[model samples]
Target: MNRLFPVWRRCAAVWVTGGLAAVLSVHAYAQAPTQRPAQSATQSPTAWTTSWSTALQEIPRIAEPPPLYQAPAVAGRTVRQIIVPTLSGTTTQLRISNRYGTRPLTIAGVTVARSAAGAAIEPGSASVVTFGGKREVVLGPGMEMDSDAIPFKVTRGAPLTVSVDAGSDAVMQAWHRIAGRVSYVSSEGRHAGDIPAAAFNVRFTQYAWITRLAVSGEHKGGLVAIGDSITDGLRSTFGADRSWPSELSRRLAAAGATPMAILNTGISGNRLLSGSVCYGDSLESRFEHDAAELPGVHTVVVMIGINDINFSSMPARRGLDCDTPHKVVSADDLIAGYRRVIATAHRHGLHIVGGTITPAALPPAREAIRLKVNEWIRDGRAFDGVVDFDKALRDPAHPDRLKTSFDSGDHVHPSDAGYAAMALAAEGVVPGAKR
Candidate 1:
C-alpha cells in the first residue's frame, strides 16, 4: 500500500477507472428498472395491459331501462334539444320525461344548442347530442328516457336552449311545476311495431328505459333544488320549461357554469317539520332520500315549510292525523329541525342555501307562522346563505300576502312570472358553484 506509483499513472487510475465504474452502474440500474417480463404470445394468446384502449373494451356495457304504460289516442311530443348550465368545459347529462302523459309517445331528433334570439328551429354550433343507436325513439305513456351520453362545454351559468317537436298534437308530460331531471313516461310506443324507447334487453336481461340523461364533461359539481309547490311550478303549463328550477338551470348554463342537475324533491304538501297533506313523508323525514341521495350534489336550495303551517290548520284535514283538532307547530320546533338537517349536510361538506317561507295569509294562521319562521330563517340563525323569497314575493301593500302581480289565482303559489322572480332571487347563490 505504501509503494509509490508514477504520479500521472496513479491519478489516472483513481479518477478515470472509478468514475467509469460508477457511471456504468447507474446506467445499468436505470435500464433494469424499465425492463418488464415479456410474455410469449404462443403461450398466453392475450396479455393484460394498462392501456386505455384495452380498459375501455373490458368495461361492461350499461343496459337500458324498462317501458312504461301506454294508451291509443294520446301521445307525448319529442324532445329536440336540451341546453343546461355546467362548469365550463365540463360534461353533463340530459333527462326527458313523459311522466304525466296519458299515452305512448315517439321521440326523434334530440339535439343541443346555444340559446338563440327567436328561431327555436335551427341547430347551432353549440349543439351536440346523440340518441340510442343514432336512431329515433318512442316513449310509452307515464314513462321516461335518458338519451345516449353527451359532452357539454358549459361556461359559467350559460343558457342552454331546449326544445321539442310533437309528432302529432301529442301533449308531453314533464315536471309541470318544478324544473328537474325526473319525468314520467308512457306504457307503449306510438304503435305496436314502433321502435320502443323503453325496452328490456334480452342479452343483458335488463330494462332499456332511459330514465336519466347524464352529461359528464370537464365541469365541476351540480345543484340540488329543494322546495315546495311554487318551486315545483304547479300552475305552469305542461311541457313548458317555466318552473323556477328549470329557469334557474337555464340561467346557470347561460353563465358558462356546469349544467346543474335539478333533483326536484318538492312534494305538493311537503312541510318543513311536519307531515304532508298528500300522504308522503315530511320534509324532515324525507330529507335523507330526496336531498342526501342525489348523485353529484354539491349545493341545496331549501324553500319549504308553508305547507306545515297551512295543512296543520286546515279544519277539513284535521281528522286525518291525531285526536287533537289541529297540529300547531312552533317556530322553535321548526328551527330545531332545520338545525339537524344543516348539521347532517355539513358533515358531508355541502353548502346549504336557505329560502324563507313564502307569504301565505289566505288562511290567516298559516300567514302568522310563515312570518315567524321566516324571521328566524332570515336572522342568520340556520342556513349558510339566505334567499328572501318572502320579501321578493310579498305584496307591497299587503305585506302578509303574496304580491298580487306574482300570485296565482290560488294566492298560495306564485304564477309563472312569480316563480321566475324567485329563481332570480336565489340565482346568485344557488346556481353558481366555484370550480
Candidate 2:
C-alpha cells in the first residue's frame, strides 16, 4: 500500500470560523486525489452556497445495461427535473457538468421555475438560465460550467423545477444514478418552456446533466455527505428524503441550529480506494470535486470503506462484473486513505467528521476489519469530529449486525428508523447542530 501520509503530523494549532473549526495540515501527500489539489474557498454568506448537488457516475458501455442505468435520449427535446433545495435565497445559480462525457454537450435553452406539480412549473416563476448572458451553452467535455446568477426567490425544502433543451446532438454519458426523485423527459421536440405536463410524458429516477443548484444568502455553510449506498439513500422510500443526511437536514432546520445545506455525494457501490465501471470513480480520487472544493462547503461526513474491505472477497461473475478490479485492502490501507482525505479537507479549511462504519452482517474475518476501522474512527481523533453510526444502529445483543428495526431488509443498508437514528448521532458532531 502507498504511504499517502506515511506519518500523521497534524499540528495542534487550529482556527475557528462560522461555528466550524479546522486544523491546518502541514504534511506531505504521497498519494493525492486524481484531480488537482483542493483549493481553499472564500466561504461567506454572500458567496455561492451549493444548496443541492449530486455525485455523478459514468454510464456503462457494456453489451447491455439495466434500465435504470440507461440514460434517456435528450436530442431535440426538453427535459424537466424537480429538485428540492435545502437553503433559501433570493439569488441562485445552476451548474451543468460534462465531466464524463466523451464529447461536448450543447444546450439550446434552460428555464428555472418553482415546481407546481410533477413536471409542471408555477405559471409566472419561470426564469431564463443563461451563461455569460447567452441562453445557449456548449459545454466542453470534462468541464463544469455554472449559469449566471438568476434573481429568483427560493425557500428551503421547496421543490424547484429545471427544464433543459439540449441541442439535437445531446445524449447522457454521465449521470447521478439512483436519484430516488422522479425527473421528466420530453418525447420529441423542445418543451423546456412548457407549462403543461403533457409534453413531459416520460418519468425516470435519475439526475441528468445538471449538477448543482447554489444560492447566495445568510447561510452558515454547507455540509457534504460522501460515501456509498447507505449515504446514497438506497432502499429507502423513494422521494421521501429518508437518507441520514436528509433526516439530519430536517432535524437541524427544525432545531434552528447550524442551519446549512446538506449535499449528498454518495454513489451506490462506491469504494474508498477502488473504482467501478458503473459506480463512478473511487471516493478518495473524486473527493476533491465531490466534496473538498464544493462551494460554501464547511464540513464533510464520510461513511465509506466497507466496499474497499469487502469487494476483494467476492468471486468474479461470469457476466459483466462492475466490481472487477476487486482490489484487496486492509484496515491499514483504509486508515491511510482516511488520513489522506482528512488532510485534503484540512488544507481546504473544512471540518471533516469521521463516521464509524456500520454493520453489514459480514463473516467474522471481514467483521473484524470493520470493527478495527470503527475503533480508529472513535479513538484515533484524526478527524475534526466523529459520528459513531456503528454504535447508533448496531444490535445491542448481536453486536455485529443491524438492529432488526433498523434493517432495510437487506441487513446491509439502514431502514428509515435506522437512518433517523444515524441523524441523531450525527447531530452531536456537527458544530451547533443541536437536537
Candidate 3:
C-alpha cells in the first residue's frame, strides 16, 4: 500500500538542509521576548488568532429516540473521570449535540472542576462552569450548540468534570467513552469567574446533551475519531481508560507532541450510511459535523460499516425482508461509501486514515460479509492510510471472528484490551500531530 508518511518524511528532511544554511548566516543575537519560533516553509508565519464560524448546522426538529430496546440504559451511571489534556495558552469550549432528541432540551448549567482523585472521579468533588456572559443554554429539539467558552489552564492527563444540568423532557443522546476519575469546579465564592478548585459536589438532576468539545489553543489542530460503538468503546469496561483513541492520545503525549487533542465522535449502532437502527443519518451524512466541524481538526480516523452489514442481515435472517434475501451487504456498496467519506475529508484538507472493520465472530452467514467488506477496506487505496484492526484482533485460525479473549461476547464490539491493541496499531498513522 503506497502511503502518505514515507513520502512526507522524505520531504520534511529536505527542508532541514535549507534551514541550517540560513541560520548560520543570521547573527542577530537579540535578547528580547519578541524571539520567534522557527517555521517550516510550508507553514504560515502568522500570529495565532481566535475566530469562530459555523462548520455544520444541525437539523433542528423533534425526532424519535434511538433503539433503547437493544441498547443499554445510562441511568445511575457515573463517569468517574474525564481526562481532558489541552495545549498551553488556550481555553476549552465544550460542544453538546442533540441530533436525535425527541424534544427541546435545556441545559441549566455546567461545571469544569479539577480532579482530586487520580484517574477516576469520586462523588461530591465537582463545580460549575461560568464566564462573563450567560451560563445557561436552551437547545431546541434536534439542534446542537456550543457552550460559552470556559477560560482555564490545563496540563496533560488533567482530571476534569463537565457535568451538565438537563431539562425534564430532555432525551439526551450521549456518546459513551471510558473516562477516568476527575475533580469538579466550584461556584463563584467571594469573587466571580475566579473560583478555585474545591471538593464540593456540584449536582445536576437533568439530562446530558454534550456532543463535542473545542479546546482553543495556539498550536496545531485536533484529531476526530469518527465511527460507531467500537470507536466509542462500548463493550470496553466502564470507567477504564482503555478506548483506543484514549490510548492513542496518551501515546501522542508521551511522544512529546504539542496540544494533540482527540474527539471521539462514535455513536453506538452507527453506520457509514443511513440506517433505521442508529437514530441519526449515516457516518457519511454526519461526517461534516462529527469530523470536520470541530474548532480545529487536522485528521480523521474512521472505523464503521459493520453495523450496516449486521442490521442489513437482520431482516433477512428473520425472513422479514425480501430485498436482501441472503442477508448480505455487498462489498461494492461499502467500497463506494468509503470513497465518499475519503473524498469529503480531503475536501476539508483533513488527512483521512481508514480503519479496517474488526473481525466479527458472528455466524457463518454474517462472517462472510465481514470478510468481504474487510478485504475491500484493506486493499482499497481510497484512504490515505489503513489501520488494520482486522489483522490486530482476528483469531489466527478463524480469520473472521475475534479471539475469544478479545471478543466482547456479542462478537461485534471489542473488549478493552482489544480496543487498546487496535489503538496501538493505529499509532503511526497520525504521529506527532497536534490539536
Candidate 1 positional error at 167, Å: 25
The 10 consecutive residues of candidate 2 with the worst lDDT sum are 1-10
RMSD of 3: 11.2
Residue 381 accuracy (lDDT) in model 2: 74
* Candidate 2 residue-wise lDDT, 174-240, digit = tens: 8888888899999889888888899998888899888888888667768899999999999889899
Residue 387, model 1, lDDT: 72
lDDT of 2: 0.81
The TM-score, computed over Cα atoms with residue i paired to residue i, of candidate 2 is 0.90
Writing each residue's lDDT as its tens digit, candidate 3 over 167-215 gives 4434334333222222222232211122232423342221134444445
- Candidate 3: regions farther than 4 A off: 1-90, 101-103, 117-132, 167-207, 277-279, 315-328, 363-365, 433-435
Better of 2 and 3 by TM-score: 2
Give the TM-score of each candidate: 0.55, 0.90, 0.68
lDDT, residue 411, candidate 2: 88
Each model's lDDT: 0.48, 0.81, 0.53
